[model samples]
Structures are given as C-alpha cells and as structure tokens.
Target: MGRIGVVTFPGSLDDRDAARAVRLAGGEPVRLWHGDDDLAGVDAVVLPGGFSYGDYLRAGAISRFAPLMGSVIDGARAGLPVLGICNGFQILCEAHLLAGAMVKNTDLTFLCRDQRLRVENTNTAWTCAFSPGAEITVPLKNQDGQFIADEATLDELEAEGRVVFRYLGNPNGSRHDIAGITNARGNVVGLMPHPEHAVEDGFGPGTDGLGLFTSALSGLLETA
Candidate 1:
C-alpha cells in the first residue's frame, strides 16, 4: 500500500482525520511533525486543516515557515502528490507552491457548513477518481477562505484547466467560484474544503470527498 504523510503542526486539528481518510482509502498513514525535516519516505503528503500556531500571524504565514515545509516544497516541485485542505491551502499559497491568497470571508465571519463543489478538472493526482464536472458535497469551515488573484492568473488557470474544483454555491467568494486547484504538474492540490471530514458516512456529509484520497492512491499505484 502507498504511504501518505500527514503533517501535524502545533494547532493542527485535522491531522488525525486526514490520516484516517488515507487509511480508509487503503493507504498507510504516516504521522509527521512540523518540526521534523524528514518525511519518512512517504509517497504522498497531506497538510490538514486547523489553526496552525493559533492562526497567529496571518492564517498560514507562520506555518509556511515550518521546518518540514521546506521538504514539502521541494517534494511537491519534484511531483510528489500533495494535498492541502483549508488552512493547508493557505500555507501552500504562502509557500509559493500554489497561486492566489486567502483572505477573510466576505461575510467577515468564520463559516462552517457542508459545501457543494464541482469537479472541474479530474486530471490532477488528487482528483482523478472523480469525473470531470461531477458534483459533490464536502464539509467546509474557515475564517479566511476567500481566494483572490489577479485577472490574468484567473484567466490562465481557466485556460490551462488547472481549476480542479469549483464551488457550486460560491460560498466564500472565491475567484470564478474556484474551490480547489492543482499545480501545473498536477501533483500538488490545494482547496478550502475539508475532504477528510467527509470520508465516512454518518459522521459528516456523504462520502463524496473520499475520492480525493483514493484518486491520489490510484495515481501512486499507476506510477509504481
């Protein structure tokens, strides 16, 4: 089975959930600490949601400088599959692994709810299990979830088919209703929704988000 690393920072609240999701998808979940520079040779990595460092300096500003993040940035550039959920997405942007910046919600409040999303591009490693244009539901929670970028960047993302997931309801006012996006190589993905929280039925929303993990595992197996 593939081994997926879940990085836990001081204030990470969803690392366990992400690990559980990986296990549910038939992969081994390896716990990694933020202070540790090693990734233990995991095939993939997940930066789960939560208030890292108490959300102290901006949302992801502090955690982006964590010791392990350097390795993550290098690995992601080399095509190691990486998924960033919620605050993880923020860190990815701050780390320059992804484009755009996350700001406060238009409503200026921390929002939490089951969000509807459409799989816009399934070619990414983290979304290949989903079909293009497929609609799914996942739990979303965060204060700084609004995605912002320049017009050219938005146009480029659209033209390049890099917009992996789009919000069906435009909850947090992301540009072009984007909910998730992947790097040009399709190995790194970041999104503001909590797929880890929706991996099991009877707990949160439906199991629609499980495809994120399963798809990554399939990608790993294909290359293996």
Candidate 2:
C-alpha cells in the first residue's frame, strides 16, 4: 500500500481524519509533523483543515513558512501529489503551490454545512477516480473559504482546465463558484471542503470523499 503522509500543523484539527481516510482507501497513513523538514519517504501528502497558526496575520500566511512546507513546496514542484483541505487550501495558496487566495466568506461569517460540488476536472491525480461533472456532497466548514483571483488568472485556469471543483450553489461567494483547483501539473490540489470528513459511511455527508484518496492510490500504483 502507498504510504501517504498526513501533515499536522500546530492548530490542525483534521490530520487524523485524513489519515483514517487514507487507511480506508487502502493506503498506509504516515503522520508528518509541521516542524519536521523531512517527508518520511511517503508517496503522497495531505494537508488537513484547521486554524493553522491561529489564522494569525492571515488564514494561512504563517503556516506557509512552517519547516515542513519548504519540503512540501519542493516535492509538489517535483510532481508529488499533495491534497490540501480548508486551511490547508489557504496554506497551498500562501505557499504558491496553487493559485488564488482564500479570504473570509463574503458574508464575513464562518460557515459549516454539507456543500454540493461539481467535479470539473477528473484528470488530476487526486480526482481521477471521479467522473467529470459528478456532483458530490461533502462537509465544508471554514471562515476563510472564499476563493478569489484576478480575471486574467481565472481565465487562464479555465482555459487550462485547472479548475477542479465548482460549488453547485455558489456558496461562500467564491469567485466563479470555484471550490477547488489543481496546479499546472495536476499533481497538487487544494480545496475548501473537508474530504476527510466525508470518507466514511454513517458519518459526515457520505462516502463521497473516499474517491479522492482512492484516486491518489490509483495514481501511485500506475506510476509504480
């Protein structure tokens, strides 16, 4: 089984959930610390949700500089598959691993709900198990969940098919209804929804999120 690393930042609340999701998907979950410089030879990595660095100066501004992020950024550049959720999404943007920035909801209030999302791009490593245009419901809870980017960048993303997920109801006032996106190489992805929370049946929204972890495992197997 692939050894997927689930990174835990000081304020991270979903790392264990991510690990459990990986395990459910038949991958070995490896715990990775935010302060560590090594990736522990894991095949893939996950940055789970939470108020990293207490959302201090910015939602993910501080956590971007965490020692582990340096390695994460480097690995992502080299084609490592990385999935960042919620606060993790902010960190990826702050680290420049993915485009766009996450700001407070347009309502300027925290939101917690089961969100409907369209799978726009199934070509990404983390989304391959999903069919294009599939709509999945997952839990989304965050204060800074609004995704914003300049028009040109947004157009570029649309043109390149980098927009991986779109909100069905246009929740959180995210620009273009974007709920998730992938890097140019499609190896790195970031999204506001907590896939980890939706991985198990009888819990969360449903088992819709398990496809993400399974997709990653499939990708790793293909490369192996």
Looking at model 1, the pairs that clash are none
Per candidate, the number of residue pairs that clash is: 0, 0
TM-scores of the models, in the order given: 0.99, 0.99
Model 2 C-alpha lDDT per residue in residues 66-137, reported as the tens digit of each score: 999999999999999999999999999999999989888999988999999999999999999999899999
Against the true structure, candidate 1 has what lDDT?
Answer: 0.94
Q: Report every candidate's CA lDDT.
A: 0.94, 0.95
- Tens-digit lDDT track for model 1 on 1-224? 99999999989999999999999999999999999999999999999999999988798999999999999999999999999999899999999999999999999999999999999989999998998789999999999999999999999999999999999989888899988898899999999999998898899998998999999999999999
- Give the worst 10-residue stretch by lDDT in candidate 2: 196-205
